[model samples]
Target: MKRVMGCHLEIEVIDPTEVELQVAVSGAWDDGQVVESLRCTLDGRAVDVREVRDPAGARIHVLDAGPGRLVVDYDAEVTGRARPATGTAHERSLYLRPSRYAEADKFFGFAATEFADVVEEHGDDAAVLLPYVAAWVGSRLDYVPGASGPTDSAKDTLLAGAGVCRDYSHLTVALLRALGVPARLAAVYAPGCDPMDFHAVAEALVGDTWHVADATCLAPRSSLVRIATGRDAADTAFCDNHGGGIQLHVSQVHAIVDGPLPGDDLAELVAIT
Candidate 1:
C-alpha cells in the first residue's frame, strides 16, 4: 500500500554561552521502499542544507546555527514494496552480529534456551521465527513510559521487565539475532501511535526477505513511515547532537492517513518493506 506520512518537530535549545549545533534527523529513503514528496526545513529557514547519508541509510542534516530555539520539520510520501530475502552474505553478516543496545551475544544463552524449540521446529524459516520472537518478547515485557533511557540495552529491559517501544525492539532484535536471524532496528513515524512520538520497530531478515515486526503493536505496521534503519538505536536516533546540555522542549510527531484506514483483518504480524 502507498501511504502518505510525515512528521514536524519543534525543539527548544538553550546553551548558556554561544555554541554551534549540528543536528542529524533521519530522512526518507529508498531501500525496499521508496519515499516521495519529501520536504525538510530547519528553523523556518529555507534549509541551508548539507546532507550526510549514514552507512545504514539515515540522512543527516548538518545545520549551521548559534541556537536559541530550533524547529525541524520533515514530510514524505512512502511507497511500500515487497522485500525479498535476497541480500548477499556480507549484507546479512552485519546485522547478525551484536551491537551496543541489541547485545545479541549477551542474550545468546537465554535465547538458545527460550527459542530452542521454535528454531528446531521451524529450521531456517525466519518468517516463522520472527513472529515467534516478537510475541515471546512482547509477552515478557510491560510497556512503561520513561522506564528506560537512551543508552539502555536489551539486558536492562529484560531485567526490568518493562520498557518503551525501543526497549521492546531491542530485546526482540537481540533474540532474533541470537537465533541466527539478521535483524536491525527501524525508526519510524507510526501514524496511529498513542501520544504520537517517533516510534521504533524491528526489521528481521528471514527467508531471504526483510520483514517488519513491532512487538509493542502500538500502531498498525502498514502505517509506519521509515525514517532510519540501524543495528540499534545508537545509529538511528532522530537527533544526534555534538554539544551542550540542550533541553528538549516541544517534541511531537503526527501523521494523517491519505485515505480510509486499511482493515486489520490480516494476521498479527505486519510485514512491510
Candidate 2:
C-alpha cells in the first residue's frame, strides 16, 4: 500500500569547543524514488542540507551545525513494494564481509553447528535461511532495553542471550553472513511499534533481492519506514558527531500511517530505496 511516513528529530550539542555535527535521519527512500516531500528545519531555522550515498546506495542527508539546538522536521511519501532483485555485486561483497557490529566471521563456528540442518535443507536460499535464523535467534534472547550498548557485537549478544532491537539485528546479520548470505543492518521508523521509536532490523540478500528480518518482532515489517541501511548500526547511526560533548534533548520519531496497517500474516519484506 502507498503510504506517507516521517519524523521530527531534535538533538542538542553542548560543546564549548569547536566541533563538527553530522546527522542522518531525514531521507525516506524506497525503490529509488526520491523524497519529493521532505522538509527539514534546524534550530527553528532552515539549514542547508547535503546528500551522501550510504553503502546501500541510500541518500543520507548530512547537516552541519555548531554548538546549539539541531531540530529537524521532515515528512515524505514512499511507495513500497515486495522485496525484489538482489543488489549489485558491490552490495553483496560488502555485506558478506564481517563488520564491526555484525562479526559474522567470528560466529561461523557457532552458526555452523546450531543451524547445520537448516543450512542443509534451505542451502543458500536466503528466504528460508532468514526466517530460520530469525526464529532461532529470537528464541535465544530475552528482550532487554538497557542490556546492551552501541558498541555491543553479535558475539556479545549471543553470549548474553539478551539485547534490544540492534542486538537482534546484529546477531541475525552475523549468522546470515556466516552462512555465506549477504545481510545488512536497517534503521526504520516503526509506526505500530509498542514503544514507538526508531527500530533496527536485518535485511538479507535472497535470490536477486533484499528481504527484511526483524527478529525482535516488536513492529510489523510492513509498516516500517526506511531510515538508512549499513553494514552495522555504526553506518546507519541516527547521529554521528565528529568531535563534541553533546546530550540529546527530547528526541522523537513517529510514522503516521495513511490508513490501517497490514496484519502480520500479510506482512512481507519491503523494498527500501
Top lDDT model: 2
TM-scores for every candidate against the unseen true structure? 0.83, 0.85
**Model 1, position 144: C-alpha lDDT score:** 92
Which window of ten consecutive residues has the lowest lDDT sum in model 1? Answer: 16-25
lDDT of 1 by residue, 4-98 (tens): 55555565545432222222224434464545332333455544556778655466666554456666656555565434224457759999999
* RMSD of each candidate relative to the true structure: 3.8, 3.3
Model 1 Cα displacement at 154 (Å)? 0.5
| Global CA lDDT computed for model 1 | 0.72
Q: Which stretches of candidate 2 lie above 4 Å from their native place?
A: 16-43, 79-85, 266-273
Q: Give all candidates' CA lDDT scores.
A: 0.72, 0.74
Candidate 2, clashing residue pairs?
30-273, 31-273, 85-208, 85-209, 86-208, 86-209
Backbone collisions counted per model: 3, 6
TM-score of 2: 0.85
